[model samples]
Target: MTARPLGVEIACDGPTGHYDCPHNAAIRAQFTSRTARQVRADGRRDGWRARPGGLDICPDCVKETTR
Candidate 1:
């Protein structure tokens, strides 16, 4: 997620109203995990990445950039 002048942006809830995707969303709802590795785990699960320079890249954007 990126930062705006106001609140931070979030990539999880997409157009289909779910993270991962709409396909699996029907089987489960979103949950907040209170874990030590939330950021890294979520990134690995969703293909997100927080760069050393402080840039946050979502899965979809990552694909575009790589291509």
Candidate 2:
């Protein structure tokens, strides 16, 4: 039997990115924050990018970029 994902993950959007099983991207998008920082924090909590830009990068990609 094949294992199915419980929730859709928000993948990293660096130079190269792929689907990841981290969190529910849909739920993450439903969240709303008053401040940019808070927005970043929320996104971060969902394994999404916290940086300010049109593009997004997952936590794993963040580590790769920082390195």
How much lDDT does each candidate structure score? 0.44, 0.52
Sliding window of 10 residues with minimal summed lDDT for model 1: 21-30
lDDT of 2 at 9: 32
Clashes of each: 0, 0
Off by over 4 Å in 2: 1-11, 15-42, 50-52
Best by lDDT: 2
Candidate 1, overall lDDT? 0.44
lDDT of 2 by residue, 1-67 (tens): 9995343334345534445424323324334454445555667777666445656676656666678
Stretches of candidate 1 exceeding 4 Å from the true structure? 1-30, 34-40
Per-residue alpha-carbon lDDT of model 1 for 5-50, expressed as tens digits?
Answer: 4322334333322234332221111255334245445565766655
Give model 2's TM-score versus the native structure.
0.36
